[model samples]
Target chain A: MKHFAAALAVSAALAVPAFAQDGETKVIGVSIPAATHGWAGGMNYFAQATVERLEKVYPNLDFVLTTASDPAKQVNDIEDMVAARHVNALVVLPFESEPLTGPVQNAKASGAWITVVDRGLSVEGIEDLYVAGDNPGFGRESGEYVASALPEGGKIVVLRGIPTTIDNERVEGFQKAIEGKNIEILGMEHGNWNRDDSFAVMQDFLSKYPQIDAVWASDDDMAVGVLAAIEAAGRKDIRFVLGGAGMKEMVKRVMDKDTMIPADVTYPPAMIATAIELTAVGLVSSAPVSGKFIIGSVLITPENAEGYYFPDSPF
Target chain B: MKSPKIQMSVVGPVLALVVLLVLGASLNPSFLAWDNVTNVLARSAFIGIIAVGMTFVITAGGLDLSVGSMAAFIAGLMILVMNSALPSLGVGIPIVLLGMAVALAAGLVAGCLNGILISRLGIEAFIVTLGSMGIYRSLVTWLADGGTLSLDFGLRTFYQPVYYGGLFGVSWPIIVFALVVIVGEIAMRSTAFGRHCAAIGSNDQVAKYSSVKVARVRLTTYVVLGLLVGVATILYVPRLGSASPATGLLWELEAIAAVIIGGTMLRGGFGRVWGTVIGVLILSLIGNILNLTDLVSPYLNGAIQGAIIVLAVILQRDTRQGQ
Candidate 1:
């Protein structure tokens, strides 16, 4: 049934070009990472929804959406879009920066407007637009929340994400935010932004530190694991855990005023929607959408948690 | 000298484990604490349980790359089953039992499918499992709708004890892992099935001429491994009460590495259930110790783990050379 509707939509899109003789149908290709994790899954959901919605709103614009599991596959996807589809614009969330730079540049060389999302290309100026979530703001928002929550400046442990530039930037921003505060970091370890890894790491941290006042899980998935470990340990020293990425369940916990999960920070996966929409506007309209669009991360407290709650979103 | 060398090779994994334990204890005062000890052991349970079954499969000259992905798929299926059944069964033991049954059944079917494809169709074990690996991973991802499949909150709370609670001081996973190891060791050493596995792995044509049912034994090995993966998933689901695309990632490599580290040959023929247990413990301890201490940079954790795995295998290899 769903595929039938999709086929119908494709047919309708094809018919639009025949009637509207004023403008030739423009093709916009969107390339993103496959939904391998919660955030990417949410990103995939939003990207697909945006493409479907935009295809209806703009009759003369057609979209080619491709998801790749790796950098090589992503590069191939872009090359195929440029060569086969003859896309007028390319919206890509690179799986990695270094490998995607050359391919995206090649797309630009083909006279396609290139919009890079999240991770930037290694060499700048190739992309007409850059859309990203504020990594530093993500960490700072989380840190600022922790500071305000524990005004006395207590000791906390941090569970970091995978070792990457994004992880590094977030951690640096968090450290800078909490630098003047009296928060003593008991320990820091990479949970690799995974639940199982964080669970094990948090368990070990529980064994190592007897009086951890709080935890900075840094990601919602890791927070789930950290919370489970702390619950199993039955430790009373930890007051609350601040998780970022605004996953639905965590936001729900904040909404209910759960003490363990007092707050969350937003690094929304829906930023992909923003990127795709801007690129669509550039292709169909005369709007100048050729600048960096960084979505600032916001702290989601209980009062504002309801607003950030995306119950329908998979994340 | 030959006798001593043989003894050393036999005890290589044991020696490596002892060294890690001592190093861990010396580095941190709480490393040997009861809680920390249980934490490490329980954490090792999933891979430990899976590696025991891997021992049988390897003994029978088969390899399974699908166990990890199979576990993920089964967990997803179990969660879906249990969640849907919650309306009728409520949030009690019956619902949990139903979930476990679903897991075991799914595992049985998945394993049987792999067994049939490889044993009946004459496909290579590596190729068959490699194909199933991609298939199972994609299935789980599709089942999850590219997100996570989480068990209902009420059910998760009620079922949490399976993972966190245990008789006496040991967690359930550790208890289950210990039981699996004990049975596995006995099977590998005492049973006719065990001898047949060794025979088949060492030389299948010779074993066939010896009147052993080579195909059945090979199929049974896969079936056992699949069932064990289901058991592992039962414990895993309750821990997080969720399954995602990342669930059980790289677990096959870890299980295979443990099997090899414990003195099981990758090329098949010889196997040891007890050694695989030790291998599981060794891998768990490396991660635990790295997390417990800031001795080296966190970035080098993978490098350090690789070095230790190589060192442990080399220790056994040198002793085998003397034979």
Candidate 2:
């Protein structure tokens, strides 16, 4: 009698309606950083917005957005999202490189096409398509801009972001560019990508160094903190305070040609959008779309600041 | 009551600060600049403000994890209110006062939620605020649509004067932080609530039997904490054009660090507002010096922060044992 009842229940479960998209559901999974910071918040916004738009455009494609605030949660999320059998393709912006390798590999092994954005994975042959902004380029361009403007190479104090791979890459790239030049990096400290932390860091930079020709505030958010501290100090020695990452306010400063902010580095948040588009085109079109994808990092100065400016969209 | 204990508390942190300076200057002479000293005090204001509150909660036998997210939520709300009213009210004194009032009220509500849930509901303050931390953070993310809501361009200059403008050659945030310390000191010293607070921390059941309204004390303390956070946000918002989800990330940790390092007992028995001020300053100074000198790699900065926090706690332990 129990066996008979179990059989009946299995039949009933099979009869339930499918949750997948109607025409021919091709599951697409999205993994992004949890909406912890403003940038990640915008990243989540773009991911969700694009998923909605894509579902409307393609009847067969169903998208699932998963957000994790930290590295471990992201790894677990990838595992859970993959195990649900809800995806034919996966797009991930990893929280950290080391911990996410196995999960991305597992999802790829399960026959899902893969794309990794922003932070890269440690596992090779995992990401079928990769989309990313150039950190080295971010550092090089900002460094080059500094070199050109300060021909004689003034004393520069650098305020770094949190100690991550991205931070290391940016600093390495920057140092490489300024090598053998007159430019001296007076000091460097990690502001941990926090505004108040950066403010304190910049303040110490000012005090520890009697004369500073300029400042490189690696990220725009940190730049805000650095600028506040500098302004509070009321020092005139800083001819320029450089910031990167194409934040809206930083872009605005570039447009206004604020004496302190003459240029910026672009690390567009729309890379997720780019990854989605490429993945969709691969599924929909006859063209070969499976390959490594690289997006150019353009330097934004007074001339091109307006083009990169998005007054409505939050960065 | 004023004895060798008070003087001992004063001597240790001062020695630590002086030693840190000596070490910093020896490593890099540029560390003694006027600008840097000013910078450390200025940036330490935020952590200092929150730590002052944590000093109360911890001494009172409670902890608050909601501060980081609560501060961000209040900042976002303050900005939204300020921007909405900018057009209706002129850029005169009234709008500024009104904006500050709204910010403070928002903080009180947030704090009240914390106080009510823990004190009244009999829930652990840590777990209660931790849940609220997620809730408040998510709410702001939803409100912002995961982006930033900056001040409208027209009102940027009008609003900026609050942060940029100074009285007596001191930044507004610094001045506000100072007043918070003074008020916190007075409240914890002169008020009836103050005496009761100590008795409660020392022995909750005993204090309860002594006719101290235990629940009311705990609840009101949170509200006061909320008010201070709100005030900090008010002074802080003008410096930044927008409020995003990252507004107060890890501030709870920093504030806790300041409290722990400031000689406040984490297990709940004592809170020292002035010790917290010095603690915040010392913590802030480390970050400043690190930025000024390339003595250590940037990656090791966290190690430095962790080490300093441990050192402060150890010194406190030593002092306690000696007493």
Candidate 3:
């Protein structure tokens, strides 16, 4: 155990000198939530791809990637990686906003430039760069797209994500966009952003409502299950189904002209990769990068689904 | 024949199902529709199978927390396997059968490990499977590199038919679930091993003296449970065309709930295969009925599920201890 720690320390030390001289070998620390579901899983994928591409393009650079299932663990992980990997700069897609703020602040305090992705802290301005997909847009776009298609005001069921500010923001935005629209929401329930859970929730919704015009499954994983349950019941009244997070399967559905999946809402996982790239560039290139990088969530209609489709991406 | 406890055991769950149906229909007239009723049964298949295996585990006085994650892991691995084979094999029926066989073997091994650790090594079943649960979940996540294990379109139709098809008027999942119930019932009744399982669960010391192979039975139950989880995976993965760690999150609790609510003792002695089947159906039915209704809030759906499960269980507990 002692030898393992020492080896990590030595390698970290060896890599630091190389990084300091050129600023080219700047260490990129990629912290993402563990793969409990599809979205985070895809984020990890892009994080990895970004690391390899940056390393090959910039020979002096190195990448250190880690994951945590929750905010508390992520804080501890940051301390561990900074010590063992000699991360010169940090890129974090936190598990939660508030619990992670202190740890991120500490990393920033120690001279590492910070790039925060997705979730934002309740306390602001600690991060040197902030990158996120607009959550409100996720809700509003999905609500607008689906509601527009059902102009006659059809009944719809909604499966929500976990109770977080992001979840709430999306819900609020969606509800607002569809406000005064003909859509009567049959019910809204938390599927906790999962396929099987959504399947259960959708099954319940199907039994509860005699007639439903559509479904807005807030997230892709839930969208997968809701569509499955709907198909099993052979319900045609569910004119279209839409979900946020450009999961490859959902994107593919739109691309293939599947009538039920007329469109999708984009909450791309690649934003983390984008964050890491910006942080890496900030260290070496002397580029003027000060503003918050808010990636727009575009509605993926059939005409635009090909642009969002990633045949190679596991998500 | 033997004072009819067995027949009553079977009848209890059926009676509960009828009550649920009546209550559901009374709450909303649409619940009785053939489409809604059939949909609830079809959606219940995953838990039905897991609960069946859990019926054996709990009745044998053991627990397996890894069942859900094990199901997800096997599903992910099977999809990965199928995806790899599709390019080479050109998306045929034979490849799917081969994939199923491999996934079943992996699940059986996982179960056997849980069994041997608990029964032979004398480890607590809870702790053993709890530890195995983390390991299995981590393995699947690592294997997929934290991404979805989607079946590409080339072979989707070839394999999709299993979850999508119906036998007579029933869904394929329901058909598979009924087959599991039948096999489980026969195993519990006619097999020497089945009698020994009951004897051991009732009293291991007494069972040992009575020439029951206590260790063998306990060890094998895990494998049986594992195989059932594998079967559940075969039906499950195609539903979404992918598997993640959340695939079977907290499912063991559901399966244990089904077994206990079905009136099986948590200790090692009793089995209620048919009761467990209905128990699973009731769980799905509660969720379905709640969603279909114009409930004040969807959050109530969980509270309702929890309430019904607790009520069913308390009712079973009171009745069992009555005589």
Candidate 4:
């Protein structure tokens, strides 16, 4: 169960500035998942920071932000916003795709501009704009890095995230990119995007295979687990571990040029801010910001790690 | 007939574990490798250690849904204490020792809170722990700001050996688990306290009539469980070098599941410490074997795990009936 208190804590931070829509002031309701995990925590931080920054810049724009732990709570949150808050526009990062569709569609019927972020809804035409991080690109860039780093070919293992369409897309992109390469994937297993689970999976991988040249831990959290297991095993053969989703700690490692953590890939949670900004622009300006906007996954190398590192970010 | 319940508790889980190991070995020869065996056993340390305490809690007719969250909360506090003290303590043995002391103390306090509320205040264990579960999880989330808390890098290398290090050729976590299980089994079998727990769980009214000090025994069980969780955190943080707010998510369920699968009566009275250890191994082995194979889909793994748990429970039920 999601913490109702945390949801309240997130919304309470941004609920003070109650502004009514008059000449150009538009109320934008921001609904996103609560900080249940590291990624979601980072998303919430960015969402709050962006709202705080934008409210000052656009004096006529007001944001009503609410965080929900589950789909049902999120649905209730949206319905409440549409009914009572009288939101002119809604920017939502759904807790899950299917559950939020009907509620969002209902909001849309009430004339709210729907800006969906990250996970897409089952029904396509309901949203006016879509902003999402590139899942395939995240894997493809990670694959491209692996291919280039081990040009001589090596034995690698994969620690996959949760079994979802996103995971499949990342794996597909990775496989497609490394199709003809000599980098043989000895094994692949799900880490469930959890640190402890990943640690256990990596330990088994280390024991099962005598020689593992490198690792592709798709998510940063799992990458942390993989690194810990490798260290605990005191294995010396591993050249480096590539983890995606530029978590600050991982990025810091890259910046420090740590041997085990050579680089990283970006699957930023700040894409919510992008959605918020676009929706705000659409409401205030004459700009037509409709259609899918996929953020490219950028590879974080030693030289560029500092640019991606956000020390203040919760993640 | 008197030994039948005992046989069901000991023999059943052992059989299930053996069958699983044999099946895994047949599926993949590498699953039987010495290193794989050690790795799987060592990885079970977290759940194994916690399940020891769960044995007491469940035997005393109590439930603790807060163990997982308490682990995370306590782990977070330990990391914070260690990091802040690292500079003054100079990355020495003293800091590590101090961290352990703090961890144990924090666990005892947290456990006592749950125990006192349930035992003294007359609240149901389930309701008390479920409330504390939310409280503990939220506290950790707040502590980490919903992120991660890593120990000082200077000490990370030294602390790594606590988990990764071993005596002679054996891994440390495995050794630790063995020690804990031995101690736990001894306490639950050889002591009057152990008998009191069984008496309390079997029937609180009967235990009270016998002048067993039911509240005191029940409260002590929770405290012991918390201490065990503390020990788990010590091993866990050293391995990961960080504690995320998500560190112990849903671990309480796994611990509870291990306890039940080990033939511990959920309604109270029966507990098998060794069986609990086997139960934990069974759970870890399931994940390990699944990971080793290419046939099982990742999504299907959860369903498979659920099926095994149900099968184990059913097997235990049948064996109990034979008595």
iRMSD for every model: 0.5, 2.4, 2.0, 1.4
Q: Against the true structure, what is every candidate's RMSD?
A: 1.5, 5.8, 4.1, 3.0
lDDT digits (tens) for residues A92-154 of candidate 4: 998889889999999999999999999999998999999999988888899989999999999
**Per-residue lDDT of candidate 3, residues A1-315 (tens digit):** 232244335446555776777654567787888877778878877876777667656656666777788888899889876777667888898888778888888888878888888988768888888899998888888888877888878889888988778899999989999999988887888888988778877876776676888889988888888988887677777777887788887788888888888888889999988898888788768896767999988998779888998877768
Query: Model 2, residue A48: displacement in angstroms?
Result: 2.9
Tens-place lDDT digits, model 1, residues B135-225: 9998998888789999999899999999999999778999999999999999999999999999999899999999999999999999999
Candidate achieving the largest TM-score? 1
For model 1, report DockQ.
Answer: 0.89
Give the Cα-based TM-score of candidate 1 against the true structure.
0.98
Q: Which ranges in model 3 have alpha carbons more than 4 Å from their true place?
A: A1-26, A57-61, A82-88, A151-153, A203-211, B1-19, B87-92, B189-191, B319-323
For each candidate, what is chain B's TM-score? Answer: 0.98, 0.93, 0.93, 0.96
| DockQ scores of all models, one per candidate | 0.89, 0.52, 0.60, 0.68
Q: Model 2, A1-315: lDDT tens per residue? A: 232244334433332333332335566788888766656655665676676666556655656677887889888888888888557889999888889998899898888889999888887778889899898888888888888889987899888877778888888989998887899987777777767668767767666666999998978888888887778667899998888778887899999989888888887887888898788777766777777877767889999999888765667
Order of the predicted models by TM-score, top scorer first? 1, 4, 2, 3
> Against the unseen true structure, what C-alpha lDDT does each candidate score?
0.92, 0.78, 0.81, 0.88
Writing each residue's lDDT as its tens digit, candidate 2 over B266-294 gives 77777777778777877877776666566
| Clashing pairs in model 2, backbone N/Cα/C closer than 3 A | A34-A68, A208-B30
Candidate 2 Cα errors over 4 Å, as ranges: A1-23, B1-10, B21-34, B153-156, B318-323
User: Among these predicted structures, which one has the highest lDDT?
Assistant: 1
